[model samples]
Target: MDLIQRFLFEDLDVRGALVQLGPVWRQIQRNRDYPPAVRSLLGEMAAVTAIIAGNLKTPGRITFQLSGHGAVSLLVIDCSETLNLRGFAKSEGPIVGNSISELLGDGRLLLSLDVEGMQQPYQSYVPLEGETIAAVFEHYLQQSEQAPAALFLAADGDNAAGLFLQKLPAADEKDADGWRRVHGLAQTVTPGELLSLDASVLLQRLFHEETLRVFEPKPVRHDYPPDREKISATLRALGREEIESLLADHGEVVVSDDLSNHEYRFSADEARALFDTPPPNLH
Candidate 1:
C-alpha cells in the first residue's frame, strides 16, 4: 500500500519520514507520455512532495516548481496536508539528461506553502544547485527551515519513494554526533531498497541500533477531480469574443490542465451559455 511513515529517535532530537508510492505515482503519469529521464525526474519530485507535505503541522497545501530553459522546461508537483498529489512536467523537446543540473540547466526552484487561514501563501526560491533532486531539497530545508536535513529520493516507472531526516533545534544537546551518525546511516540506502522494502523493515535495516518509535502509516493518493464549474468560470474570464473566435477557428474550445491530467472541451453552444449565466460571486 502507498503510505508515509513517521518516526522519532527516543534519545535524540531528530525525526524522520519514509514515503513509498506505487499506485498514486502511476496514476499521476497516466495521461502523459514523458521521456524516460523526464519521467524519472517527475517521479522524484512526487516522492519528495509527499515527504514534505506529510510533515506539515497545519492543514494546507505545498507546491514545488522547477522552471528552466532546457529540454525539461517545467516540473510541478502539488501535495496537500492529507497527501493528495497531482503534477506534471513540461518539456521543450527530447530530454537527454539524467541529473537535475543537466535537465534544468539555469533554472530556479520555487516552493510555495499555502497554510490554512493565511491570506497569502509563504514562498521561497533558490537557484538549482544540486546534482540530484534529493540534494536540492536538502539544501532548501537547511536554508529555509534552518534545520540540518538529509533526504534520499528515488523513483522508476513503477514506484517512487523517499527517506527524510531533519535535525531539530538543539539536537546536539541530546546527542552531539547523533545527526551526523544518522545522516551517514541514511546515505547507505540504495534506490532499489527504497522502492522495494517495507517501511518498518527498511528502518530496521538502516537504524537497528537506535532507540526509535515508529508511528502508524498515513495513506497517500492521487486525488484531482475535474472542477467543471471552475473551468467554465475561467472560460468566462477570457470574454465571449475570444471564446467565439476560438470556436470559429477550431469548432470547440479546449483547455487542458496538464498538471491534473484533465481536459475541458466546450462546444460552441456550451461556450456561449457560459456568458448567458451569471459569474460566480467572489465573496
Candidate 2:
C-alpha cells in the first residue's frame, strides 16, 4: 500500500504531512520509457501531488498540469481524495538536457480541482520559474490557499517521497513563532528520513517538544479513469467525424456493445469499464 499519513500539532496550530512512495513509484515508471531527467521530474511532481491531494478538502480529484512551449509540454497528474493517483507527461521535444522548466517552457503550472462535476474547481496558475516543484507549489499555496507552506520532496530511480508543513490560519499575531518553529524543525528532515521513516516517527523527530496529535494512516488506492457513459461522452465529443478520420488514417473503427477487443487501439468504451467496476488489485 502507498504509505501516506497526515499529522497535526494541535497546540502549535500547524499541520504536517508525509507521503512515502516506492512500489507505486516503480509502477509509474513501468509503462513509460522516460529518460532520467523526465523521470526525476515526474517523481518529484508525483510526490508533491500526492501529498497535496491527501490534504485537499474534497474527495474527488485534483490535477497538477503544465503546458505550453517546452521540451515536455504536458504533465497531467490525477489525485483522488483516497490518495489514488496516476499521472504521466508528454515529451514535446528530445529528452536531452531537459529540466522541468526547459520541459514546460514559459508555461504556467495550473493546479485544477475537479470535484466530479460538483463545485467549480479551484485554479491558480503559477509561473513555471519555480525551478523546483517544491518552490512552485509553495508559491501556489501562498497565492491560492493563502497559507505559507514548505515541502520536502525527493526521488530516486525507483522511489519517491514527500513531506509538507503548513501554517494554519489564526486570528492572532503570535502565529509567526509557531510557523518559524515548525519551519525550522522541518528543515532538519533529510531525504532518507522523508522517504524511509514512518509519519509518526518523522513528526516526533522534527517536533519532539511540541505536542503533536497524530492521525491514523489513511489508505490510498489507485483509481482508473472515467466510466463507460463518461467515456462515451468523451468519445462522442470527439464526434463521428474524428472517429472516422482516425479509422481512415489507419483502418476501420468499431464501437462495440461490450468493451473487449484484442488489439492495441484506443477503445474508449473498453477503457471506461475499468472505472464502472473495481480495479484489479494493484498489489
Candidate 3:
C-alpha cells in the first residue's frame, strides 16, 4: 500500500517519518511520457512531499517546485493534507544527462504551502545545494526547521521511498548522545533496502535495538482537482454558437492553462449536466 508511517524513539526526543509510494507514484506519471530520469526525479519529489507534509497541522496543500536552466526546465508536485497528490513536468532542450545537476543546472527548489482560506500562501526557496534532491531538501530542513535532521531517499521505476529523522529541541542533557547513535543507524539504510522493504520490516531492521513506537499507516492517493466550475461558467457565457466555434476542432473545453493535459471533454449531454449539477470538490 502507498502510505506514510510515523515513529518515535522511546529513549530519545526524536521523531521520524517513513514514506513508501507505489501506485500513487505510478499514477502521477501515467499519462505523461517523461524521460526516465525525469520520471525518477518526480517520484523522489512526490515521496519527499509526503514525508514532510505528514506533519502539517492545518488543512491545506503543499507543493514542491524545481525550476532551472537545463534540458528539464521545470517539475512541480503538489500533495494535499489528505495525501491527495498530482504533478507534471516540462522539458526543453536536448537530453545530455540524467544526474540532478545535469537535469536541473543551476536550479532552485521551492516548497510552498497553500492553507485553506489563507490570505497568502507560505513559501520557502532553497538553491540546489546538493547533487541529489534528498541532500538539497536535507539542507533546507536544517536551515528552515532549525533542527538536526537526516534523510534517505530512493526510487526505482515502480516504487519511491524515503526515511526522515529529526532531533527535537531537547531540554534534557541526558539524551543528548542519542542523536549521534540514531543518525548513524539511519545513514546505514541502503537504496535497495529503502525501495524494497515494507515499513514495518524496514523500521524493525533499522531500529530494532531502540525503543520505538509506530503509528497506523495513512494512505496517499492522486487527486488533482480540475476547475470545472470555471469552464462551465465560460461555456455558458459563450452560448452554444460561440462555444462550438471555439472547441469545434479541439472538441473540448480547457478549464485553465495549468491543466495542460487534462481538458474537460464534455459531450453535449455532459456539458448540460456540468452546468445543471454542482461539481464536487476535487479529492
Candidate 4:
C-alpha cells in the first residue's frame, strides 16, 4: 500500500508532506513497459502529484501534463482529492534522459486544478526550466505561489517517494533562522534515502531538532474508470458501418489507437451489454 503523511513545524510556521508509493506505482508501470528514463520520470511525477493533491482543500482533481517536440511527446498524471491516481505516457521514439530538460526538449509543464463547484478550472504553465523534477517543482512553487518551498523526490523503477516543505506566509523575522536551518538540513537527503526510508524515520532523521506535529497518514490507491462506461463510449463513437465491419471481418472491435499502451477488445454482444448499463456520473 501507498500512503501520504502531513506534518507541521510546531512554531516555525512551516508545513510538509511526505509520500511513499510502492504498490500503486508498480501497478501503473505494470500496464506498460516504459523506457528506463520514462519510467523514472513518470514515477517521480506520480509521487509529486500525490504530495500536491493530498493538500487540496476542495473536492476536485489535479492533473500534471507535459508535452514537447522530443522523443517523448506527452505525459499526464491525474490525482483526485481522495488520492485516487492514474497516469500514462506517449512517445514517438526512444526516450533517453536523466533529467526533465534532456528528456523533454523545449517542453512545457502544466498544472490544472478542477474544483467541483468552480465555474471553470484553473491552470498554470511553466517552461521546463530545471535539471531535475524536484527543481522544476521548487521553481513553480516559488514563482506561482510566491512561497519558499523545496522538494525531494526519488524513484527506483519499482517504487517512488517524495517530501515537500514550504514556509507558510505567516513566518516572521523570528523564524528566519529556523527556515534556513530546515532547508540546510533537508539538503542532505539523497534520492536513495527518500526511496528507502519510512516517513517517520526519514522525517525524524532530517528534523530531529525541530518541534514537529505529525498527522495520521492516509492511503493512496490506483483507480481505473468503469469498464462499462469506457467500453460504451468507444462503441458509440464508431459509425454503424464501421462497427459492423469490425464484427464481420475482425471478429472484435479494437477501441484504442495503435500507439496506445493497451487495447480494448469487445465482441458484438459485449458491446450491446455496455449500452444496457446506466450512464456514468457526469460530474
The best candidate in terms of lDDT: 1
TM-score of each: 0.93, 0.77, 0.83, 0.87
- Candidate 3 on 95-143: residue-level lDDT in tens? 7676778988899988889998889999988888887778888998899
**Candidate 4 segments whose C-alpha is farther than 4 A from its true place:** 245-251, 257-262, 268-283
Q: What C-alpha lDDT, on a 0 to 100 scale, does residue 56 get in candidate 4?
A: 72
**Lowest lDDT 10-residue stretch of candidate 2:** 256-265
Candidate 2, residue 81: the lDDT equals: 73
Model 3 weakest lDDT span, ten residues long: 252-261
Error of 1 at 236 (Å): 2.5
Comparing 1 and 4 on TM-score, the stronger one:
1
Assess candidate 1 and give its TM-score to the true structure. Answer: 0.93
Local distance difference test scores for all models: 0.90, 0.71, 0.81, 0.82
Give lDDT tens digits, candidate 4, residues 129-168. Answer: 7887888878887897789999988887878999899998
- Candidate 1 per-residue lDDT, tens place, 4-75, comes to 999998788899999999999999999688888898889988998888888877768999999988889899
Error of 3 at 177 (Å): 2.8
Candidate numbers sorted by lDDT from highest down: 1, 4, 3, 2
> How does residue 81 of candidate 1 score in lDDT?
84
